[model samples]
Target: AQRVTQPEKLLSVFKGAPVELKCNYSYSGSPELFWYVQYSRQRLQLLLRHISRESIKGFTADLNKGETSFHLKKPFAQEEDSAMYYCALINGNEKLTFGTGTRLTIIP
Candidate 1:
């Protein structure tokens, strides 16, 4: 079975501090990883995906096969960045699994 785990349920950082949301997965075959963010009163949106190799909102994540991890990182945190982040994975069968999610809070 494929699964996604987000170690942190709640994370807080200073306005300009670095932010990292840990994500680990368990799967037998190659899976597609994604980071989804949901802002206040907004719908869930895609932040980034491993295959794209792109950075969004100053945040980037690298898929480490050996570690089976895809942790999201941002050099500097912004107040607007505060939101609920979910790590998800989809297997070859197109079955999607999501983590419990992490709520990020930015403190001034």
Candidate 2:
């Protein structure tokens, strides 16, 4: 069974500080990885994808197939960036498995 795990339930940081959200997955076959973010009172939207190799909102995520990990990273955190982030993976069956998610709080 493919599963996505986000070890942290919450991550807090001050403005301008760096941020990193850890994510690990277990899957037998090749999986498509993505990071989704939901800001306050907003619907969830895609942040980045492993295949895109592009950064969005100053955030980037790299897929490490060997380690079965896709961690989200940002050099500087912003108050507006605070939100709930979920790591997801699409299995061979095209079913998306999402992590428990992490609530990011940025202190101004």
lDDT of each: 0.95, 0.95
Clash count list over all predictions: 0, 0
**Cα displacement (Å) at residue 88, model 2:** 0.2
Instruction: State residue 72's C-alpha deviation in candidate 1, in Å.
Output: 0.2
**Candidate 2 colliding pairs:** none
- lDDT tens readout by residue for model 1, 37-99: 999999999999999999999999999999999999999999999999999999877777999
Write one digit per residue (lDDT tens) for candidate 2, span 57-98.
999999999999999999999999999999999976778899
Over 4 Å off, model 1:
none
CA error at residue 86 for candidate 1, angstroms: 0.2
